[model samples]
Target chain A: MARTAGSDGERTEAAIREAAVDLIARHGYEAVSMRQLAARVGVQAAALYRYFPTKEDLLFTLMREHMEALLGAWSEARPATTDATTRLATFVANHIAFHIERRSQTHISNMELRSLSPERLTFILRLRTSYEKELRAILRDGAEASVFDLDDIGLTAMAVIQMITGVIVWFRPDERLSVEGVTQTYLSMTMRLVGATTNRETQHVHAGTRLRA
Target chain B: MARTAGSDGERTEAAIREAAVDLIARHGYEAVSMRQLAARVGVQAAALYRYFPTKEDLLFTLMREHMEALLGAWSEARPATTDATTRLATFVANHIAFHIERRSQTHISNMELRSLSPERLTFILRLRTSYEKELRAILRDGAEASVFDLDDIGLTAMAVIQMITGVIVWFRPDERLSVEGVTQTYLSMTMRLVGATTNRETQHVHAGTRLRA
Candidate 1:
């Protein structure tokens, strides 16, 4: 319906989705409407209809696309290192970065997932399952290789995802904390939580040792 | 307003509030209605007016009371202990235990805070501010006493609270995991997160230590 063959149409559609995301993230999905979105986009209310058939469809579109984008970012940033510890750390660091970079997209995508249609809900869960599977594989491999200490690797992987993804709700880009610093903080915290003793344990044992410049 | 003099009326009102908590916690706050609460309480919709004046009033009442209860719990749990390390551990452990015991209450308290009237909303924020003041006092004391090595104690406290609170979304008491085990795990993770070392940290420092006991 959008006639999205040209860049102009695509741009218009993108604008609608952006407006939808902002409005939903601020006021929640149920409180958002196309007329409000149209006004925000500086378009006629009917113009939005060409792109999104209904308000719910618009929200669903935003969530589906956002989730896919998140999954895609993970797939893209995956390093080639076969070391499970490095791979898992990279996975978490990349995830924290993605959540910070696209906070609004991630926020609405998470909060509005409960309002999605059954089929779309299942689709989103499947995507999440794939995402979880990738993380679990690295964790499973780590546990097997004696690099990571974990019980029920699947649950530990899920908990790690939850802990990292939970960062979006509170992280502020304009704050004093640098992304690198926050990522290292979480990496250290998670390593200890999962009983990974390689670095943190060594540091604690040598608490009196000064770091080499 | 209907008579509030009798215990019968008080019991009915309490029942209605409990039902609202359950309904709203299962669905979101927006999706629940007075009629649904009435149905859940097995009473007439009009009779609900005998207790609370309006739908929004009921929501505000439940959320306001829940916050007060959480605040009360924190106050009752805090002891005048000499050791900052023991005090901080007690606080985090008690916070986790409260949530595990009343996950539904915390869920409602969080989800419905946005739905409060501005006047009631102030109470919510004031309550939160007081809670933070108390927690930060411990963190500051710990930092000053040389028991904690946190660069940003306030930010660290906020992160720890958010991380622990976020656990409610995923924890299941019926699982193979015990509540004590989960609490101990989180407590250990938290102590290590704040740079506090323990026997486990020393044990884990050994290169060949097994992960599980």
Candidate 2:
């Protein structure tokens, strides 16, 4: 597979964004200056400004792209099934994988929201809400089908998102558990939290088989 | 009962911490300056320095006290029951209440950790470990007693904490749901996630009584 290399301008812009995520994640968005970022990226300050007109613009671009990437990942990973349990499992797996791989970008996306302009903040939040709405829809459908039990779809969706996104907080690639293991455990927890009937059956078998050992 | 007033110095220190939490929460810790903080608290920079010799010292103190306050709150709210379900309920409720009440402080504590020096970061993380250890112990004991079902104790503890503490992210005093109501829903979710046998019984009763309506 022959791949065309990026042009020099495109490569410089990519380097700028990469360096920005690292510096901002380390020192925070407000503390990181465009000059410092350009210095780290080995580009002139003027070149950096050519890519991002302002500091806030850089932050907004990073945040917007992060959310867009997440939404994009979920769309690709979403299973072609009406079964809520399977759909939710895909959502959790996709979420944990996406976050763990881009820990720095995810951190900036979450923490730098306060620094975004009001209009930009609203734009990013709207993206977040739409992403969350997908999970809420799954919960709603599950509850209606009587295949899952939940007290509130909105709250459950938030809980599931927080609980799974937290994986990046403590997880390390060299750690004892592999990503697959962690995702499986979290998937079970999610299923149980929502009271999926399949989870209950699995739990019974697991308890019967494993508790004695 | 008669109350004693704090000394002027003590009141000034308290005011600085409050203002710092607000400012740091609004803008990242690296972006907030001692001069700006002193201005917010209506104190001279020298007076602020007399209380916290350096900006990092101020940040370290704010974070250290936040964790200490959380640990103290947990100790007070900890139930006297041997039952894991009851203890877990108390933990969830206390955590939600504590974070919700100190939203700004919680935000600063969670976000400003990267700004701490290595030693200070270790101290804060140690306090966090001790706090999380309590939840781990409960999960371990529950697993032994066969009251709660879980794949990983550490993972479950992290999930429950993140899920409950996330209430502060979206909750507001003027929201449609009361804090108590929100806590109840989370408690139920936590109970289900752990696969507490007691929760199953409650769920059956709840479903029988409420799902039909």
Candidate 3:
């Protein structure tokens, strides 16, 4: 959805979301009350309700938006490529870049699934499954074309996702490595992990060179 | 600590710990109260304090014990062989097994560090550092001996740990894959991630043959 820049309602909603993500990420979803959230946003409790009807509604919105944002980011970043190696490279780079930029939202998305009701949980899980399936498809294509060697596609996909997503846990922008440095190392490790088909084929492919526009 | 079987006090403490783990894992650390925990254990709030002086004390105890247990498990599981590949294989299997069995404890340990006091958090972090350091040592030895090719030891160790620990997230014993099946696949993925050397000397090591005990 396109945002008309600088509207009162949009601004309040954004502020509420920003505060909610911070609070929920710090204290967890179950522990955070709408009153406390309203206080954090410097608004009345009724005003907060006007934006989010219930505590669970606020949480569901946060989680759903996080997943939606991730899906949108990936879609925009996805490159136009047929080579499995390049595709995998772009996937890793995009994932790291996106997650590191939204650390708190990412943390909430991962840690607060228990707070979501069954139906809402199922919806969020579907979003996650679809996102993950994209990576599985890449692995399958690579394995089928002999560009990557994989023992178990499901396990590899999970491992890669966990490994890459783990960057947000310890990464600091001021750390010794730049984002570029970390991405380079992870890309190389990913390629090595999959045992990329041939040195000649992989040596020419630069993961950073072909990221999504 | 050795438990005197059937002692009321010891059983009460154990029950409290178990219930607290479940409650905290389900609702997060900050969301769980000592009163709720006492109720879950069918004990009084006063009795709960007799064992754990404060709420944070209970959290610290849980986090500390989780790390200590992990360290002890790895120590016992550490192999006699000097081969890095064998050592890594053992680490993966033991980690996956230990974590999958105590899913709630693992969840609390990973998710509740935010609730720990600074000093206690440091203590827990120190324990984690030492455990991760063990993995780093293995990677260093393997790199020096040319049994493993790694881009960065720290990053690789972190990646391997997160990837292996993540098994508890989606893994259930009654599912399509058994523990052994999952371990074998993860073992292969871990080996491939490190780019295990296939040299005349290193190629002879077998990860699958030397696991689970």
Candidate 4:
């Protein structure tokens, strides 16, 4: 009996998180009320409070989980090889796949940062900085090894993150392009942006043209 | 006396618009109320309604003007030369400059699209498509002229747009990097992403290193 009740509690919490992401994504965090969220979850407002004492807690939980999931994804996708080129390709692919799968959560994570209190906002930003730091390390290593050409590691890292994350803004699983195809093209562009030595081969495959070299 | 009244009315409207952007950016559009906005602008609710009859109307106005201002800025910044590289650089520079100057409006413009009525949403999207089309043309011309190597013109255009428009997210007029400096670096990165030949020179200057070629 206790096991069943615990399972139900877990299921309810999961449902609430999902609904909260959707609602907050549609309506900004400030505009979404706990009452509305409770109704959407088919739970009593009192029960909702039992789980999340405050609405800001719910928003912060979503944002934190989004970042944590992203970090976890990257950890799994991180290649064992020391080759910076391969590492970068993996980073881009992992990022795109993770974000594409959770579009609403990604939207909430990106758009609702303003709603987080100063301390909570700092926590989120720290997580983000840590994630971005991994990319910077890759860029820096590639530059040091003379495999990737870069101007400013920090700026390049930011540009790549923004470009890839922006994929969720327009990408839909359609006939004309699959996630694999889009990831391949973005990989090529990113390789070129970093002046990676292997970019010629990648670009040639996508452009369907012979390189001058 | 009539001229003075007209000017006063225009000033009041401008104040309302500015306050709206700030409020909406700080708190999401759905969370912001006209009463709160009027208080911020030091006006009565009725006076606020005199300029914008509905909250959605106010939102649409802010968004429409943001896009129009962007298009206007691009038009003025559009160089006469047919050189795709030059045109692309100009577009990136103008976009970065414009968005950095209007960070709050840019945020509202990006985040508040969900709040627009369907018709207003379509209108705003059409304006966006037209602006993006200009970049597509440049990419197409560059690809045709063999000046810029591209895999997919459409994907490339979106990637470039996202990469440059992303400047407003983190960039500030700080002592570490000025607007000109950041724009120049991004220009270099954009050039490389498209596989432009001139990227070699730009990369050399920024990287402070010799290229293999």
Best by DockQ: 3
TM-score of 2: 0.90
Worst 10 residues of 1 chain B by lDDT: B204-213
Give lDDT: candidate 3, residue B115: 91
Model 3, range B1-213, lDDT digits (tens) per residue?
A: 223335678788898899999999899998989889887877778888999999999889998999999999999888898988888888888888889899999988888889988999999999999999999999999999998988899999988998898898888876789888888788778888898865322322343444423
**Residue-wise C-alpha lDDT for candidate 2, range A13-124, written one tens digit per residue:** 8888999999999888888899898788876788788889999888898898999999999897776879887777778777888899999998898888888779998999
lDDT of 1 by residue, A1-213 (tens): 234335487788888887887777666677666788888888888888988888878877777787788788778767676877667666777788778888778766656666788898888888878888998898888888888777566556656777787676666756677666666677666665566647654433222121110
Candidate 2: segments with Cα more than 4 A from true spot: A1-7, A199-213, B1-7, B199-213
State the C-alpha lDDT per candidate: 0.70, 0.83, 0.84, 0.86
lDDT of 3 by residue, A135-207 (tens): 9999999999999988888889998999899888888867688887788788887887787865634533555
* TM-score of candidate 4 to 2 decimals: 0.92
Q: Give the interface RMSD of each candidate.
A: 3.4, 0.7, 0.8, 0.6
Candidate 2 whole-model C-alpha lDDT, 0 to 1: 0.83
TM-score of chain B of each: 0.84, 0.89, 0.91, 0.90
Candidate 1 similarity to native, TM-score: 0.76
Off by over 4 Å in 4: A1-7, A199-213, B1-7, B199-213
True A-B contacts kept by model 3: 0.80
Q: Model 2 in CAPRI terms: which quality?
A: medium
Screening candidate 1 with a backbone cut-off below 3 angstroms (N, C-alpha, C), the clashing residue pairs are: none
The ten-residue window of minimal lDDT in model 2 chain B covers: B204-213
**Superposition-based RMSD of candidate 1 using all C-alpha atoms, in angstroms:** 6.8
